[model samples]
Target: MGVRVLGPRDLSAARAVIARDPVVNVFVDSLVQTSGLDPRRGAEVWGYVEKGVLEALCHAGGNMVPVGAGEAALRAFAAYALRRGRNCFQILGPARAVEVLWEALEPHWGPAREVRDDQPFMVIDGPPVITPDPLVRAVEPVELPILYPACVAMYTEEVGVPPQTGPDGTFYRSRVAELIRTGRAFARIEDGKVVFKAEIGSVGTGVCQIQGVWVDPERRGEGLAAPGMAAVVELARQLTPVVTLYVNAFNTPARAAYERVGFRTVETFATILF
Candidate 1:
């Protein structure tokens, strides 16, 4: 039993592993599909192979996501990350997988800066139960200036860090722009201000993971999140077979809004932010 680095030559094998759970695996699937398993792009995949058969895989670098896991494989992947001085932004996946991997990682890596231990991994298999908000629509290129502030506010509020941690906010701005370019960004604009917003954070492996959902602070009690989310899910389904997202269990209002929009808790996810 050994874990080895995977590269472009292992693309088919990687695809097969990711396909096992398209929703939970889309972030890694997108990386491998677009970056081709290359370390050059600051991301690489490692496979837990035994007897020449790949049993599990771990994605390292930007996000330390593990898929197709087993105890042995998860432990090995964690050890590898420890050895490489892993500084990935988060470790997210099925609760069991992330838990086992973290068990191996935490002893050596020390305390996590932040953790959402009870994130509800939700999915929508069909059209939503709520009516889609007609105001919510795909954000256009011209609206980036109007939408960028809302995106920044949402990211900062949800993640507990200023997205402009870079020299001039260029890194965060470019990332939001890239999502908009892909037509994955959506928002409800009213009077030239974004009132509600969401984005497809990952797109691959027949799924899209929605993230960065937000409603303006003043509009919080206006009953916008449910219908707004319904619209977002409808738009997201046009690009993938399904939509998935993980929300902190403590966020009761968000949870209720999502349930009203037809998303069910399919699994549990844990996220450790470094």
Candidate 2:
């Protein structure tokens, strides 16, 4: 078996590999649908071929994500990634695959900043079970000023660091604005403050990945998250048939909220953040 950079010519075959698990591969599949292995899109996919079949791929860029990778494929991808140097901030994918790949890369790229090994990959493919929160609605573009701080707070609280270190938060702000513009950002705002918020971060292959789910610390026990997520599921299904998200296993409340909204664990993922 050999691993090599995939190109536009390999689009169909590469997509076949991603299609093996649409839910787990939605992030990379979205990139393939939009960019088709074009490096200009900020990433390139590396394919692993065995017995003349394209069996696995790694999305190489800011986030290195492996799809359909087995034990052998993981080893080959690790060698390729090692040769390419550590340019990614994280290595994330199916739990066992990421575990094996990191086993190969850690010696060379030791001392990772963090390793999140127990993330439940959950999905909801049908209408939400709970009544959707009528008050939870898509954020309007003009409301970015209100939503922006909540986003930063969510990022800092979840990731253990603020999204931006400097006073200027242009990049993170622009991303939030884009989500709002696309009607993918949802929030429950009261008194000009975001009480709960989430965004559809990645969409492809009839699946959409939800990210940045947040409930205001002050409003934690007020029963906001589940209905807010139910509202998000109703809105998200307008764009894709399936809604998926992953949560740190330690985040019991968030996990319970998602489950209450009709999501179920389908897989496990691991993240090695550097």
Candidate 3:
């Protein structure tokens, strides 16, 4: 068995592996499609080859994502990632694969800042459960200024880091603006403040993976999440056939809200944050 950095020549084979489970592969596929398997494109794909065949892949760079990789491949990828000295903000994907990869990297990386070991990978293949909240809508460019703080708050609370650090929020603002331009940023606003928000973090094949879901602390119990999510789902389906999101298993309330919205756990996912 051999593990090596994949190149453009390996794109088709790598894509096939990603295609085997597109939802789980959405983040990697986004890089492949846009960046053409080039490491210089801010991401790279590594493959484990067995007798001249690519058996598994690791998409590592800013995001260290693995797909369809078992023990051997994961070990090699972890070694390679550690050697390259790139910042892997997160390692996420199929539960078993991610766990295996994390185990292999544990000695080198030590404890992670956070480990979400049992994130339910959920899907809404059918219509979302309507929650009768008429306030949810896509955030407009005009509202970016008003809603940017909420996005920052969600990022800080979820990732344990302020997204807009170092006297520069331009990049963060542009990212939010881009999402709004793509019509992917969904939010509920009241009196010029965002109360609930979510975004289609990645899209691939027929699915859009939802992320950055946040509800204002004061608005947590107002029956806002289900309906706000329903609105997000409604708009997302206009672009893709299926909607998916992963939540920390210990988050019973979020899990319950998703279940109420007709989502079923299609698989379990793991996330390791550095």
Please give the range of 10 consecutive residues that has the lowest summed lDDT in model 3: 162-171
RMSD (CA, Å), candidate 3 to true, equals 1.7
Encode model 3's per-residue lDDT on 1-274: one tens digit a residue: 7778888888899899989888777777777887788777757678989989898888777678888887877878878877776577788888898888888788888689889889998999877876636788888889988778998999998888888444664888888888999888989898998999999888888888899999999889988888888888888898888889999999898999888888899898888888
Better of 2 and 3 by lDDT: 2
Point out where model 2 deviates above 4 Å: 164-168
Task: Judging by lDDT against the true structure, name the best candidate.
Answer: 2
Candidate that beats the other on TM-score, 2 or 3, i.e. the better one: 2
TM-score, one value per model = 0.96, 0.96, 0.94
lDDT of 2 at 108: 99
Clashes of each: 0, 0, 0
lDDT of 3 at 218: 89
Q: Between the candidate structures 1 and 3, which one is better when assessed by TM-score?
A: 1
Q: Which residue pairs clash within candidate 2? A: none
Model 3 stretches astray by more than 4 angstroms? 164-167
Q: Assess each prediction's global lDDT (C-alpha) against the native.
A: 0.88, 0.92, 0.84
Candidate 3, overall lDDT?
0.84
